[model samples]
Target: MKIARIETFLVPPRWLFVRVETDAGVVGWGEATCEGRSETVRTAVDQLAELLIGQDPLRIEDHWQVMTKGSFYRGGPILGSAVAGLDQALWDIAGRHFGAPVHQLLGGPVRERIRVYGWVGGDEPDEVAEAIAAQVEAGLTAVKMNASGRMSANGSAAELDGVVRRVAAAREVLGPERDVAVDFHGRFTLATARRAASLLADLHPFFLEEPVVPENSHLIGRIAESTAIPIATGERLYSRQEFLPVLQAGIAVAQPDLSHAGGITEVRKIAALAETFDVQLAPHCPLGPIALAACLQVGFATPNHLIQEQSIGIHYNRGADVLDYVVDTRPLAFVDGSIERLTGPGLGIEVDEAAVRDADRRGHAWRGPIWRHDDGSFAEW
Candidate 1:
């Protein structure tokens, strides 16, 4: 079927949704939300629409190649995220046309259920023990929390002890069996990361995410070598080329966000590349249902998949939650911290176009928080 029209909607709680319609009346939906830059990605999608309108909707890979590399200036967050949404929509159409789920089209299932984690503590984490307990009560086995709000370049011993104390609280609530992952959120320098890693070894964290900013990934190998804890990054890296160096740095897990890393088309390749290095794939998804569903489809087909991150009750969802815009919540239903493989066609979760359009009429201007140190130097948030 020929692609007849492409539409994009900027919805509440910081998300951008794309709808692709074909001459045969098949409609497919995908999310291209880049947390703080949803509007820019929407504009990118508008520009990329010139390439897809009147083209064959089923030619997903061909369109992806052209949409990505057709522009000389290629592969940043805006362009990659735009191509990502279009690719997801095209995959959705293909899966429906073939009467199969996206995972089946990608070589079928590798696991029965994909384990997922929930976010507990907020940005400046406090009352973490209670937060962990509440998530455990909700049938979640693992939870992630920010390590600290704003950290000094060379934090005092008290700051280091405070970090340990927060993790210790989570460990106490989770006990020895469950998992607790600390997300440094690129707020630490290499030295601080090494020190924190050394201190947190006794806590047995599942992984340390984004110890430093993506620009400083060259130093991750040293941090990885300093501690036995698994180092996870790549939420900020958009393509396999950006991920190659970090994988070589001895990171045990690769966390690629499907929305920003060229969607399923490119992340599948990223997963394969990670496989060659014996690293596990735990997609970084803190967005809406479509993005989470896309991540699950890849997780189901990937042999080395570790876990999935969902934004069900994540602090980012202020006005609207992940399930609010979906018609059927069953596709996203979580039981015992894992979701059974989705059996529906396309991304598997149907989008509520009515709710989406309504929310678009009252769109949100969501931006990430900015923090500063005690002396007014800029801090990562």
Candidate 2:
């Protein structure tokens, strides 16, 4: 079916959704957003629509190649995220047309369900023991939390102790049955990250996420050598090419966000590339329903898949939770902290288009918080 029209909406709690309509009357939805840069990605999606309108929606690979390689300047957060959303929509349409789920098209599922983790403790962690307990009570077997709040490049011993304390509390609450992931959030420097890693080793965290920023991937090897914890990063990375060097650095896990890393089309390639390095895949998804659903489709089919990250009750989502935007949250089938396979066609979750339209009318301009150190210097948040 020929693509007829493309529409975009900026919904609540910092999400951008795209809709692609075809001549055959089948429509597909995609989540194409870069958190704070929803409007920018929206514009990019509109610009790419110039090439997508009247084209065959079923030609996903061709559309992806053209949407990405079609532009000489491509593969950053904005453009990649825009292409990602559009790519998901196209796949959704293709699956619906064939009356199959996206995973069925991707060589069928390798597993019945994928384990998912929830977030505990806010940006600046406090009362983590309580948070961990609550999530455990809610049936989550694993939970992740921010390691520190805008730590300094040269962190003090107290700061290092704070990291140990938080992880210790989480471990105490989880009692070793469940997993706990600690996210440095790219807020630490090489020295600080190494120190934090060394100090937190006793807790045996599931992984340490983004110990340093993506630019410092060269340091990942050193960090991996120093700590036994699985070094996970790549949420900020947007393409397979960007992920290659990190995988080469001996990163234990690749946490590419399907919404940011060129969607299923490119992330599948990234997963394959990581597989060669023996690196596991834990897709970074902290967005809405569409993004989570897209990640699930890829996770179910990917062999290197380790775990999935979801934003259920995440701190950033105030009023707009993950299930609010979808019609059948049951299809999500989150059980015992794992989501069962998606059996429906396309991404396998029915989005509430009316809710999307209504939320769009009351569209939000959400942005991440900016943090400052005690000495008034800028710190990553």
Candidate 3:
């Protein structure tokens, strides 16, 4: 079928959705959310649509190569995310046309159920305990939380102690059977990250996420070698080229966001690339259902796939939730801390186009929080 039209909607709670329809009346949905840069990614999608309109939708690879490298100035977050949504839509259309799930088209399932983790706020000790308890009460076996809020350049004694105390409280609530992943959020320097990683070794965290920001990925290897804790990063790294260096840096887990790292097309390659290094794949997906659904499809087909991240009841959802826009939430239903493989065609879960359209009419201008240090200096949030 020929691609007839492409449309992007800036839905509430900081998400960008793309709708692609073929001349044969097959409609596919994809999410290209760049969080703070929704409008920019939407514009990129609009421009990229110029390349897809009137082209054969089944020629997914050709379109991907063109959309990504066709422009000399390409492959940044905006371009990658834009191509991601369109690529996901094309794959969705392909699966629908073939009357099979996207995972089946990718080579069929390697596992039955996909393990998933929920987010817990960790600003305060009491709040951290309550959040972890809530997720555990909801049948979740694993949860991820920020290691700290506004961290100092030089690790403070209180900051280090608070992290230990809070995570210790989380470990207490979770017991030894459950898992907790600590995210440094790129707020800590290499030295601080190393120190923190060393300190938390006894806590037995599932992984320490983004200990150092993407800019300082050069330092990732240092921290990875310094401590036994598994270092996971790559939400900010947009492509396989960007991920290669970090993968070589000895990271035990590779966390590529399907929406940010070129969708299923490129992330599949990233998964294979990570596999060669014996690294596990835990997709970084804290976005809408479309993005999460896309991650699940990739996870099912992937052999090294680890746990999946979902944005249900996450702090980012102020007005809308991950399940709010999907027609049948059963496909995304979590049973015993894991989501069963999706059986429906395309991305598996059907989106509520009406709710999406309504939300688009009253779109949101969501941006991430900016933090300042005690001395008025900029801080990572």
Candidate 4:
């Protein structure tokens, strides 16, 4: 069937959803949320609609190539994210048309259930022991927390101790049985990250996320070599080319966001590239239902998949939670710290069109926090 219409919704809680309708009464949904840049991605999607209308909905790969490479100035967050949502919608349509889940189309199930990690604490951690306990009580076996709020170019010993203390608290609650990961959020410089990594060595963290910013990703391999803890990054990276250097840097995990990194088509290729380097995949998904569902589909199919990150009760979902716009939450239900392989067609979750439309009418202009150090210089947040 041919694509009849493509619509985008800027829903609450910093998410952008795409709805693609085919002429033969089939519809597909995808998420194109770029966190703080929803409107820009929406514009990019509108531009892509010029090429998408009347095309075969099942030609996912072809559409992806054109949407991504059709323009000379391509492959940034805007275009990549726009192409990402459309690609997800096209994949959803293909799955529905073929009567199988997206993972099956990729190659069939490699795992029975995907282990997922929950987020504990906020941008700046507090009462982390209690937060870890609460997540464990809620049936999560692994949880991740921010390492520090906004760090200085060169952090003080007290700040370093606080970072270690928070991780220590989480480890104490999780004990030796469960897993705890820390996210630096690209707030640390290379020197600072190296020092922090040295300090965190004793805790045996599952991974250290974005220890340095994407711009300074070349230094990641050094950090990885200095510490035994697995290094994970790529939430800001949008293509396979951007991920190549990091993978070669001996990064233990590649955390490409299915929503930001060219959706399923590109991320599948990214997974393959990481496989050559023996790097594991843990998709970065802290958005809404559509993004999380897309992540699960990839996780089920990918062989080297490590774990999935979901936004069930994440700090960002203040106004609307992950399950708010979904008709069925059963597929997303986390049991025993893992999500069972989805048997349903497409992305394996239904989008509540009514709720989406209602929320779009009262659209949100959400933005991520901007921080400044005491000296008035910009700080990463």
**Could you tell me the lDDT of residue 104 within candidate 1?**
99
Off by over 4 Å in 3: none
* Number of clashing pairs per prediction, in order: 0, 0, 0, 0
lDDT scores of the candidates, listed in order: 0.91, 0.91, 0.93, 0.92
Model 1 residue 10 distance off true place after TM-score fit, in angstroms: 0.9
Clashing pairs in 3: none
Window of ten residues with lowest summed lDDT in model 4:
121-130
- lDDT of model 4 at position 199: 96
Query: Cα RMSD (Å) per model?
Result: 0.9, 1.0, 0.7, 0.8
Stretches of candidate 1 off by over 4 Å are none
Model 3 C-alpha lDDT per residue in residues 1-381, reported as the tens digit of each score: 799999999998999999999999999999999989989999999999999999999998899999999997978899989999999999999999999999999999999999899999786666999989999988899999989889999989999998898899999999999999999999999999998988999999999999999999988999999999999999999899999999999999999988988889999999999999999999999999999999999999999998999989998999999999998889988899999999999999899999999999999999888899999999998
Order candidates by lDDT, high to low: 3, 4, 1, 2
Provide TM-scores for the models. 0.99, 0.98, 0.99, 0.99
What is the lDDT for 220 in model 2?
82
Candidate 4 lDDT by residue in tens digits, 328-372 = 999999899999999999999999999999999989999888899
- The residue ranges of model 2 lying beyond 4 angstroms of the native Cα positions read none
Error in Å for residue 229 of model 2: 0.9
**Between 1 and 2, whose lDDT is larger?**
1
In model 4, which regions exceed 4 Å deviation? 122-125
